[model samples]
Target: MTKDQLLEMVRDSTQVMTLRQKLALVAMLSMPAMIAQLSSVVMQIIDASMLGHLGTHEAAAVGLVSTTCWLFGGVISGLATGFYVQVAHKIGANDAKRARSIVRQGISCGLAFSACITLVGLLIAPHLPVWLGAEEAIRGNATLYFSIVALAMPLLMMNSLAAGSLRCSGNVKTPSALGVMMCVLDVLFNFLFIFVLDMGVLGAALGTWAAYFITMVLMMYFLVAHDRNLRFSLDKVQKFKPHWDTLSNVLKIGTPISLERGVMSGAQVAISGIIAPMGSVAIAANTFGVNVESLCYMPGYGVAEAATTLVGQSMGAKRQELMRSFAWISVMLGMAIMALMGVVMWVFAPEMMAIVTSDADVIRLGTEVLRIEAWAEPGFAAAIVTYSVFVGAGRTMGSSVLNLASIWGVRLTLALLLAPTMGLHGVWIAMAIELTFRGIAFLLRLKFRLKIRE
Candidate 1:
């Protein structure tokens, strides 16, 4: 079916959809998103490969602060969800005007919020490497790289807001397409800055920043002028001011998710600290391993995106059964796909690691870690899609709580216990176990909270 036709099907709440039909819809929405996610993985692979060639120090520098970058990016993305979730509900209710209004308010609030994040990130960038216990050798480049990322927070936030809004309004193709394009641009810019200008780690950050800037503009244009359900009229004066009700709603939905991201990304930063003392080889290995492994799980994220949109629309329609069905179907499908990917990762672990780096020691270490992490993909997929399902259904607070508990209570605790003896392998083992536990927890919650009458 065409995108419009599939979207129409999604918006139609009256019809009872068959299982095959539900699967088809999920798959359709997921394919583009999956492609987009894979492109992002490809971008990361290219980045790692380029930096790897430069020398282990350059890769280690960017890797050092990458978690902090995620911390900042995650907060903005969670905030965007606050706005876009409302839009999804409104669209489901066929209230295009209300959706557009939320879109306007989202822009203002998101930018302001992101500006604050930028300030905080900038303040911390200089000291972050030292705080993480990075070796003196890589600290300067790490600081510079993070500082650039901090400065680009607003652009990243805008991209997150625009992309989330479009996806929620059944315009996933636009964001997905732009995501692929952004990957290409990122590669080109990285090439120019790193090889041509010899900017090294700084070049990697600038390349990403430039790509975000360009993509943010295109995404905003599509969101405002092109979307059928969400387009706002420029001819009529539209208020960009935030209404108290809308802002309150955003906070209510967004806060828990944002806090969860904060806690989770904070934990990641802490984990980076744990890895830092292991020296440059371990640092580079962890970075390359994570990038290579992302190829396996990014499809799950793509499916999670589809889950959020589907469940949000279903919740908006007040079709409880449909919402729950979509949640289960999406979760199961994601698990299956990632399970397959896990096998691929297991068989080609060395090759995957080698794609991003030529350092024999780094590749061997990375290969081992990727194999360790591969077994967790099915569970990881479950947690990923289930969390999105919960978010779509506006059940973020409880799920977020459980999620935080799992990472901190289970993952971090295990990582601490294992790292000294087992090293990077210990850290990944902790991750795999925590992901499995998290998956089980989320699955139980979904079943209990969304049970349909027999």
Candidate 2:
């Protein structure tokens, strides 16, 4: 067999693309996504570095409520997924008008949902730090940070909808470019709000809020006015409100994914509660450790975004071979990049931690956890990209269930058992083991699904 056929990760792709062409196609789609995701990680790393200079207490304060913030953020993303998946499918089917129609409906529904989130966040902000068991000294920062997040919810929701719509329409460059712009805005704002104003953690939060709000407006403008697939004609009647059928289709695809993210994010909140009592050093370490790992996992997330869009479009076009080929290619590429990153993380763990913080104890502990976690990075990448493939193919529920079970059943249970004895090490070990299991399971599932086609 020729080398191209031998490297074929999926049998169906035999007639779809040669090895060189597939690699080029994956790069065309994945590069923009990679850039966007990397920008996000850089934003986080910068935030962490800025906060770290304020000492362990300031860093710990943000860490205490980070998971809670993620919980809400995860749900919001889920909501966006509902509408955008349909857009992807429509675009794949070469129905640009329908895709544009979905964008309009998405904006309306997303804005309404965001309004509700804002109200909910306002009600919950004052009390959330206490609920998460944060120390009294740190609670004020947590409260202020969440309040800003609440106020920015509308803008964030708009950005998510607009960006996802663009991605689905095969225009990753605008969103990627916008993401870099947002990161730059965030850094500048944080410098003024945090360093110049000396606002500490609250300043960090405000900067983040301003960045998203501005980026949202810019991105939304692009989607509404400039996008090829999403720019609707002005004369269309009932332009904003989508039909019930269209709305349902979005919900049908997005609900399972939302539910999955909701539960997983909630679990993260619970895990954070467990971590809160471990002292400021531990909390800082946990936070910094997460950031450090971002260097390794960011590529996986980037590749996953590409897989989702490519697979979603392929499915919409009813090109099963193309979808399978894209899926395997993305997954393999993600695994390879992440594996290399993981090795770098292992060797430079201390340096990575040092970049984020100067506290010797915090850096030392964070480095250890990162090294322990690095072993699982490739598997983690596998699960990340594969799930996106599943989502694109309208098979999100099963992957969601597997992820949920792995996090809650395997990770949390082990963490609870190990934390008392092993402290932060225990918690991270549980995470590592769960990620490895999750990755293997996802790959097996992908193999089985392809086997059915054979």
Top-scoring candidate (lDDT): 1
Supply candidate 2's per-residue lDDT for 198. Answer: 88
What are the per-residue Cα lDDT tens digits for candidate 2 across 1-454?
A: 4322322322233245667876776787678778888888888988999999988888888888788777777778877888888888887776778788888888888889888988998899889988988889998888888888878877877898888888877788899899989999999999899999988887898899889988998999999888876776543753777799887776777777878888998888888988999999999999989987998888888888888887887777677777888899999999999999999999999998999899999989999999999999999999999998887776777888998999999999999999999999999999999999999999999988742122
In candidate 1, what are the lDDT values of residues 1-454, reduced to their tens digit?
A: 6656765666786677788888888998899999999999999999999999999999999999999999888898889989999998888878888999999999998889889999998898889999999999999999999999998988987898889989998888999999999999999999999999998888998999999999999999999999988778632768889999998888888999999998899999999999999999999999999998899899999999999998988877788888888999999999999999999999999998888989999999998998899999999999999999988877788889999999999999999999999999999999999999999998998888863223
> What are the lDDT scores of the predictions, listed in order?
0.91, 0.84
Taking all chains together, each candidate's TM-score versus the true structure is: 0.98, 0.94
- Per-residue lDDT for 313 in model 2? 75
Error of 2 at 350 (Å): 0.5
Query: Which residue pairs show backbone clashes in model 1?
Result: none
Specify the poorest-scoring 10-residue window by lDDT in model 2.
Answer: 3-12
lDDT of 2 at 392: 77
Top-TM-score structure, candidate number: 1
